[model samples]
Target: DHQGKGTTEPGVMHQEPYGSLLPFGLHKGYALATMCEILGGALSGGRTTHDETLVSCHDAIFNCMTTIIVNPEAFDAPAMQQEAEAFLSWVKRSPQSGDAPIQIPGEWEENNRLEREREGIPLDTNSWEKICQAALQAGMPEEELAAFRALAQ
Candidate 1:
């Protein structure tokens, strides 16, 4: 059920009945994946992971996700806010698995944004290289790029 003997194949971790254990257990993850395949793959015109369509540049097959935004004005603000706060409080009150305190979904992202605002965003070497490449392609002077790097440090 695989390709020829010597061919480099996908990692065993990605195979069915095994990959289901990656983040969530089989039952929940399998259902979520099925729904995503239906909505993101079948609904979107874009290619699904199973699609054999090949592009020369990359080996990864991509799926498109559909996002719908909800307007806050359509719902009760104060009452909903109260319920959300209560739920978060209840979740946090659960016994901790480790010394680190529990954080709600948006908390880490909000903290990161605040930290980056106060102290400039930190980019890894590869990301900084990409930024330099972009600036260079846009005709930025090498001297200015060097200065920018210096300022970043």
Candidate 2:
């Protein structure tokens, strides 16, 4: 049974329209998930969600990520580098309505990560209080918290 089926459980609840036409056509999503099962299960010789009672039970969750590491010197190195640079430059120069500049996939995340490390991560008061409470519950002394805060600086 799909988890989307209505239940009176206390935790988070999610329900979906069961008819032929679903919101955003969830049938499409189901079809895609079915395709993933075929690729990750049958093709890869792995177990899928349907094969187990618990959703987490699986031989291995196959990652479809494909990475190509090119030895530029083997090919036309300079030309390949020039072409990639030109393409990136064109993408960055493309018109946008937003105030900030357009960024490629990892660029924004890398920048944010660097900025947060340099300037300590800003947590809301409630979240900071919750963290302190958790630390206290875990038997973390005030001196230890102060030491951790000093390390952050």
Candidate 3:
């Protein structure tokens, strides 16, 4: 919402329309991103935007990721699962917005996965064309691409 031309303060100079990309929670979000960069880049011994990697290719992009996995059972909080269930139930009890029912974090994604599995995934014509082009470029035979394209329809 804050990216648009009129979103900024009156005196503030706006960038391109909807061009301002701020962190999610302003300062807190910025701090979180910085922490991730340090952990992912420095700790992982991978290059951040500041550090140069793959000196042979100027156009190469590098990605560094850090995943932290914690077991809830390791904690002494016995009521954690119950409390989480109660919170999820409370959130689901809220009124629906428009035609869609209220959903928790992963509910929508799970439902979408199920639906797409039952019924094939949907793709627009433009995207399908681009996918076919990519397949052709990746050395897929024209006859094979046509067969897959037929199945898509």
Candidate 4:
């Protein structure tokens, strides 16, 4: 949909792509995105990126987000643990049809965490360099950062 190399305009069917940013699943994605912005911005009394140029967002502003925390101990701790275990057991009992066993949402995350805890997390060279840069900015000594660099490998 271009007349030249630099002329990357939208196709005739997709007019003004940047101005009319269409969602992947049409109305469904639009609704979800709208609701998410409403909850994070409107509910928190914070300004949203909507109706503002992208450049304006870099100005002094705090993007709001809501996080819900539940203390299991405050509720029926033992019963909740038992029920959770039972549900996991039931789900795991299902016959595996894929290369990997069926896993609930956070199961792989938990397993990954345990693995990382045992045999430290690996970081790529570029990401490790960025971390070193940030740590230096945060007052970490260059000498101390060398220790972290060793572990990053």
How high is the CA lDDT of each candidate model?
A: 0.70, 0.65, 0.73, 0.70
Which has the greatest TM-score? 1
Give the better candidate number (2 or 3) by TM-score.
3
Each candidate structure's TM-score, on Cα atoms with residue i matched to residue i, is 0.58, 0.50, 0.56, 0.43
For 1-153, candidate 2 gives per-residue lDDT tens digits of 134564454333222221122334555677876776677666665555443523453223455432447677887566887898899999999999979999988999999999998896888878877887899899999999888767644
Candidate order by TM-score, highest to lowest? Answer: 1, 3, 2, 4
Output the lDDT of residue 118, model 1: 98
Model 4 pairs in collision: none
Q: Which candidate gets the maximum lDDT versus the true structure? A: 3
Residue 58 of model 2 has an lDDT of 27
Residue-by-residue lDDT tens digits, candidate 4, 1-153: 223233334552244222334555765788877776677777877866554633565332357886668888887567898898899999888987778988898889999999999998876778877888999999999899998777665
Predicted structure 1, TM vs. truth: 0.58
Ranking by lDDT: 3, 4, 1, 2
Task: Residues 43-109, candidate 3: write the lDDT tens digits.
Answer: 7787654415433434223577777898998999999999999999998888776987888888999
Worst 10 residues of 4 by lDDT: 1-10
State the TM-score for model 3: 0.56
